[model samples]
Target: MFFLIWLVLFLVVVSFLLLLPASWHRAIYERYSGGRPVACPENQQPAVVSIDVRHAAVAVMDGRPNLRLSDCTRWPERSKCNQECLSQAIQAEPYKPGEVKAGRKQIYHLPVLLAAFAAWYVGAIWHSHYMFREQWLQAVGLTHAQVKQIVWWLSPHLLTAGVCLLFAYGVAWLLAVSHRKGVLQGVLMSVLLCGALIATTWFGIARLPHDLFLIEAGYIALASLTVGALVGGLYDRLVLPSQ
Candidate 1:
């Protein structure tokens, strides 16, 4: 009943969110390249393309054709009749005009997301369970009912869900970073995101927590966003073109 309805709603939200990026890419490709000749603005020269031979494996797997230079002053093959076609093709080269694809290589993120989600949840639940059942039960400090009440009121499950969403956002942001990689980028992004979260909170949107616990939760969300951005930046370095 209640659980079933919750599951259904979660599934619906996830499905729609998952489809959004792919649909966005599709719309972008559809609009510009509707079989018309791609025009380079007067100031813009034709493209000069190159690939990294060091990462040849990735390049090969990424399967778009090599771009042909329109000005065949470089290539031995040329014709007066075919210069425009050659020029058009040079523009087309490895990637078709207006058809921007993600990458030849794939590092699946679902497993990473799932693993992080599981690890965080497990840690949080174990902490709550031990606090309520074993630790609090043995201590003269808190009665069993009191321990249960604390855990129930704090709602570890809701906190975990919030952390998970933060994780998702962090990973997505990491893959979207414009520059930098590895620890440097991670550290910087963490700093920026945490700062943003804290600074934004000061604007007086949500009720400020007077307690240490929720202050930590807010920090955790901030950390998650930073980590997510780091992951995303690294992935972009590997999978997307560097700007």
Candidate 2:
């Protein structure tokens, strides 16, 4: 019964994700498509700007839609001017020189990279000889000798590192898009994302032993929390301020 319920919820979530992009694309195109008159931030002169609606629509999946001018009346010669008029065009606000508009938040690369390394390190410790190394080997039906024979690049460690990096970037993207800062918010977002992962783990329940499933899920939860705290709390409070 639990599995059936989970399956239904999973389908609903998947359908929502698949449909959201298309809905966003249509809405964005309807609202921002075609040429619109915008006051240029450089000289405060009136200019007709054409936005790349298709590009902005596609970028909606990344949490923030990137607005770029496909063509401007002052193009070819004055094209080198920064496209600050985009904000004015969308918000219907007068261009203010030197004033930063509230738009896409910058993703901090250092924090994201550190978060990925931390997650990878947690996995390394979790699977080491002092931890579940023997049990994991047994669960996978692989002997120590067979495990040692696998090439370094072909091993799970490299895959884990890659996955951790991607997950960290995803967390950063979520934080940036949602304008969520601090450790608590990070943990909350990470927990929600991890819940999705745990739900998918149900599919492998029949194939994996209970111990193995627990071992993997436990590591994922721990790593996710660590990343959330580091990126959300530490980075936001310490690193972001210093920058």
Candidate 3:
């Protein structure tokens, strides 16, 4: 499995998600006997319409108003997000009519996404190291054992990428949903949110052993944000009849 393979898989997953009918997310959660549309609370629904809402939310809430420099380097013993930010989060978009409103918009689905990212990381890291090992071996390479060690070394980027995904979508929703922001605004918000995520994690995270891995993560953040933002803005622009 090469990085290209992993990247293709990532794109494929997203593409399949797109084909499943625009309302598939709501349908997946609806799972009720009644076929009638259900009303979701503002929180239970996606704050925005994009496919990547989960990522936006995590990126938005990655830090506190007063978190210390030290905390950035250390992973908290447990997850805690209640009132993590001083400012009131912009409200999520209104639930579609007839949808029951949940108390809070699920702006981000953290646990589910973490699981997904971890899976991707393992796959990508395995692919990257396997290739590295093969080249290293053919050239004058290291042992299989050494290859495994290299895999372990690159693990931090995987974890950091996952962390960055945490809040990326929540941010998109904050602007596009709660604030009813225009496409450009939503895209800009998402870009800034992602930029903040890369900066905070790269600077604050402890034990990032590989500098190239760090560079790759930074580049990935930029790439992912650009993709996410352009997708959103373009989607919005295409909606106009004039366009």
Candidate 4:
């Protein structure tokens, strides 16, 4: 029953995540565009717009449009068009939003390995004694002996380490593909991935008790957030510069 629930959940989450790239692109596009035009200011020449392509901000070069001396001369003083304004426009940097740079594929192995261990440690502590051990086991209707037997078969250290390592790799790859870097970015990405990957399964299956799902899902979310931060920081500091 446990395996069946997990398998179904995995399939569903994978499907959802596969569709995430298109949604992510749209989000980035909207962010850059400000999703709307700004109201034009009074007594000013039409603004010149440009894409920054690095910081992802749209810059409106105010009081300046591509102009020739003939264009400004015709407008005169009343039009707010003058030689000074034209010179200012010439000197001003274009307000163009930066393009979305792709994330680098390189992984700094040491940091990711350390992060994976940290994730496993957090999960162990959180599940074993810190938060949800007794309540979860009881909710799942598993006895102490059965729990021990399962742990023995799965091998706690190996299972935790292996899964966390895989998760770290996936998170790093996602960050690269999404062209995002930084601890905060990582945390957000991890939350989205965890929600789609783990929470979806728990909610959709409905076979597990609510408490059990909550306990397990909460731990997964926490672990993903912390691990993402660590990996993101490492990638920015170590890997990003090289690329």
Listed per model in order, the count of residue pairs whose N, CA or C atoms clash below 3 Å is 12, 0, 28, 11
Q: Give per-model TM-scores.
A: 0.36, 0.55, 0.30, 0.52
lDDT of 4 by residue, 43-145 (tens): 3544332222223222223522233222221121223333444444334443344533211345566657877988998887887845788998888888888
Q: lDDT per model, in order?
A: 0.45, 0.76, 0.42, 0.61
Any idea what lDDT model 2 has?
0.76
Assess the local accuracy of residue 240 in candidate 4 as a C-alpha lDDT between 0 and 100. 24
For model 2 the local lDDT of residue 8 reads 100
- Model 1 misplacement above 4 A: 1-50, 53-112, 115-119, 122-144, 150-156, 177-183, 203-226, 229-243
Model 4 residue runs over 4 Å out of place are 1-103, 154-157, 199-204, 238-243
Better of 3 and 4 by TM-score: 4
- Local lDDT at 47 for model 3: 21
lDDT of 1 by residue, 200-239 (tens): 7866634543443353455466445445544544443333
Model 2 TM-score is: 0.55
In model 3, where is the ten-residue run with the lowest total lDDT? 66-75
**RMSD of candidates 1 onward, in order:** 21.6, 17.1, 22.1, 21.1
Candidate 4 is scored at a TM of: 0.52
